[model samples]
Target chain A: MDTTQLLKGVLDVAVLAVIQEEDGYGYDIVRRLRAAGLKEVGDASVYGTLRRLYTAGALSTYVVPSDGGPHRKYYGINTEGRTMLAEQRASWTRFANTVSLLLTEQHQPTATIRTIGDKS
Target chain B: MSTTTSPTLAIHDFAAAVRAALSDLPSEDVEELTDGLEADLTEQAEDLDAQSFDPGDAVGYADELRAAAGLPVRGKPRLPSAWTANKLRTWASAQRSNLTRKARSTAIGSRTLDFFISLRPFWWVLRGWAVYKVIAALVIGNSIASTLPSSGTEWVLLLLFVTVSVQWGRGRWLPWSWLPPFRTLVSVCSIIALPLLLVLATAWSSSADQYVEDYVPQGLLLDGNQVSNVFAYDSDGQPLTGVQLFDQDGKPLTTVGDPNATPWVTTYAADGTEVILVPSSDVPGRTGWNVFPLNTVDSVDYYSQPSGEPDLSTTTPAVPPFTQVRPLTQQTPSPTAPPTPVPSSAPPVAPEPSATPTPNSGGDK
Candidate 1:
């Protein structure tokens, strides 16, 4: 499955998970996502996901003043978002494990053919 | 050099960079992200400068950071929302409904009533006094026509034209080219020529004195002998007595002939002067007396003062050939005493010789 298409479905969940760890501003969230190996995610996409989650009531926002620049708006996960994140994480783990088990069963036939043909 | 670079300017530049990168997103999302990133970038730049950062290396590091964030180098235009698209649709529908309602109400079937109703809006919008003046001018013209003699109708019409043209002049409703020359012609006629023509008509008609004998009532008597009476009634049931005699001020002379009397006598002399009366006695077999003078009367039947006098100085009679009789005050007595009653068996006494002179006096024994 294409991870890009899958990412669209889970973007809001990812944003909520990142904010749940610790409240962060939009650019900081993008930086952390990049560090965590989601380098393919665009800045506009991350911002769009953050705004969608906020509008959907999964994230709450607050503004903090800055001495050297414009004000910062920080987003944090609420109770509903925390509950949803846990459920998503559990579902992802279960689906990944099931896929791993099916792949292992498919590889067993290839392992038998290699043992019979190569005599190594 | 790093100290000279203002932190405010640095933050503005950083915010602008982020905005340029995310500007293709919806406006609300772009604004939220720009606000958040500006604060984060300012803090990081301040910290890096505090640690003895080289300017050349800082620009490269910022470039790498911008690339990693996947922001566009320049700003992009924002798109409108689903709400805006739906709002435009709703507004168009409302406009169509309003237009349809107006068209339905103003359809051809209702055109006449609609025209009258449409006048209401324009009625208030017009200069109210101009409308009032036009109506007033028409009414005054009609009144003047009705009041004057038949020959004076044209003069009244001329006066109406002059009045209306003058009003139009002050109102500036028409171009000067149309109004000035038209007004000049009407004014000249009304003021100069019309009155002179009226005088000429009066003089010419009066020169040919023609008499027509007709029965008139006693109550129409003005003074002693002069009387006027109606020969017929008009369509409005008013008496159409054209013969009116007046004093110098034009007041109508009083009538002496009784309106209800029967077989009334009316006379016009060769001089066109007239008299009317209800006689007390009739000729043999005549139901009531009716007579007319063959020639001008040397004297009126009675002597009396004029009645219904009008200011005659400014007024000219329409038909000047006929004299309008001054009103009469009393009736004339018969020339002889009436016959006395005789007892049934006795022959009637012969009348005294003196009694013969006064006929129908009734008082003689």
Candidate 2:
């Protein structure tokens, strides 16, 4: 399975989790996500996801003016977003655990292998 | 490397190119992108030797940096939303196709409509004889005032003409139901009262001229009294005794001396009837000649010298016999008839006059 497709399913939850750690700018958030081993995440795709999460009320934005360069827009998760992330994380963990158990279950073998001329 | 172009200039040029490429983006986004690109270029410039800088490589690097920064790619630009991208594409295509043509045609159509709307009523006014008459009266009045020597009156008449013309034009152009009550009143007054007032003023001025001709002294003359003619003589009559001239205000204008005084021929009939012959003198500040009977002189003539030709050619025409004055012995009947008797059922009081009367006063008393 493509991890990119899998990450697409969990991108909003991942973004919310990152912001839950600390509020960060778009580029900073992308760097943090890369540090966390999601290296295949495209910059444009993360930015798009960030913008969508913001518009969906899962994240809030504030401008921090910087003297050395352009002002940076920082995003952070709110209470409703935290609650949703927790619930999605819990459901994903439970489903993954159940699938793992089913895959790892041992099966008992039945009866015999036939030989060419069995016994007379 | 020998060129004087600054590194900042190159950076700014790059930024302008970026802006041009990203013209469809929002203003805030464009500003952010330009700022970020400039910072990146400055860093790149600081790291490399200025003399070894290549503009093509710099542009290609800038494009790569922009792509890394999550900006939309040039050829296959991405929008924030799919719906917005489609809309922008459609609008840009339409703009590229016929924007200037549509703008030019719209401008021409609007201007033509405005021109016709502005001019239609004035053309109608010119075409209609009655409307033209009122406008002509206003124009004549205004022109007369404007040509006069006084600047104050010229300004006043100019203001009046503009105001009346605008009001009248509005009334003529708009329907009655569309007009406010005050505007309707102004339109009516401009059409009717203003012209009538102008005619009356002119008539009053002429009447004043007649008064001056009858009463004012003209020159030293040897003939009949000037005062008696105030009631009867025509200023243009024959046997001119003295010439009377008047100003525009109808006041008798005096000359510097008796030399500049208007001269006339005088004659008398045998029965003490005097006839004055006043010739026309086109002197500056003088208007028309007048004759008057000698007795009607309200004031004495100070100069008493014979002026001009005393053509006493007994060419004096015969005077008609004067009617003798007689005191009345009996009361004369009133010129108006007695009031007719009202019927017993009718009221005794007379009927009131109508709203407006004929000049003969048949209806309105």
Candidate 3:
């Protein structure tokens, strides 16, 4: 049930798509991702992916200070992140189509009889 | 605490655990990674099917954070050496704090030290290094210089000192075979007693400077050999500036024919002109000479400097008599007492050759 490996490749696009709609802090993003049916998503993985995208200049971030709890760090998708999301989505579809066709392709097996008379 | 603990404390503990796991990362990155984790944890904890969160799960969360952040994983299989060292360090710190509770919680002394140390957390950041300087200055003294193995050896010792001291402040004393036992004890004891020792060193350095006017070229000068603080004092203890020395035994000590080049040749220069080398630079740990000189006599195998090369080899016989010590010179006092002024020590460098590393109250492994 752990889709961590599968999720890793597509996470960058998934995160950018979520934040592109609206800015969200860490826990909010996790809740949104879970709601989108990415059930096995780990909390830190999303946080890390968000940080990674922000670091890569694909996303932008800002902090909103708080008194007691730690200040909130909000991430929002920018031009680069949006471009990356589009590119990844296109490639993912192409790859998925190729794999899907192979899965659905039908094949028939054929057999030949051996000629023992020539051997004798 | 059990996993069934309340969500509030669990969130705090979770944050602490995550912080601890991410400790080796850059401070900026750790801050960014941990930002809002507690607030998020609090919200997540409440919505859990069970109202409790196990703090043990924090590491797994940290791993996820690291991975998604494009940081390296903890790896599937841990290297045994690193694992053991990590365990030892953790154990040492916990024990250190537990053991030093009394020292840390005491009245005025601990409070003031803590206040200053807290104000400059950079001091704590380099607590690893400050701990080294304090130990080198106060406890180990000149032994480090002379006993040095090489740069590599020093690097290893430095690494070891940093490793041990970190936990030591917290209260852990690791008794590993590779770390010589006495050094371990000294290091642990030193970290535990550092604040008190620094207070004592500062106080002692000041008073000793007042009582000991080593600049007078009298009071059996210490460490003059390493740097020039030499002044030729007359039979009456009156300094004869720039006067060349004549040993009681009349033996030339250094190749330079000047004691200024090798001032540490003798504690007391005899009545005849003894070259007194006065150092122009400041000493490392503190400024100026103090009367409470370390009895470095045994540790240093003093050589007659005439050859320039230290005569450590057995082939070079008998330590120069009055060759240094003009020990015979202390017996005779100058007829007239010249008024002496105490000057603060300004030794620029402190270096000792480690001919034989002294085993401090332990057998060196």
Candidate with top TM-score is 3
Superposing every Cα of model 2 onto the true structure, what RMSD results?
Answer: 26.2
Better of 1 and 2 by TM-score: 1
**Residue A2 in candidate 3, Cα distance off native in Å:** 4.7
Tens-digit lDDT track for model 1 on B46-87? 545634422233333333333333333333332345445445
**In candidate 2, what are the lDDT values of residues B94-154, reduced to their tens digit?**
4543344333357786677668678956643332322333444556443321112245654
In order, the Cα lDDT scores of the candidates are 0.48, 0.50, 0.58
lDDT of 3 by residue, A44-89 (tens): 8888988888876678888888787667888888876776687788
- TM-score attained by model 2: 0.28
TM-score of chain A of each: 0.80, 0.81, 0.80
Number of the top-ranking candidate, with DockQ as the measure = 3
State the lDDT of candidate 3 residue by residue for B201-220, as single tens digits: 56766766777865544233
Question: DockQ for each of the predicted structures, in order?
Answer: 0.10, 0.04, 0.54
Q: Write the per-residue lDDT of candidate 2 for residues A3-48, one digit (tens) a residue.
A: 9778777777777788899998776776788789998765444655
Instruction: Give the CAPRI rating of model 1.
Output: incorrect
RMSD of 3: 23.9
Q: Choose 1 or 3, whichever is better by DockQ.
A: 3
Clashes of 2: 17
Ranking by TM-score: 3, 1, 2
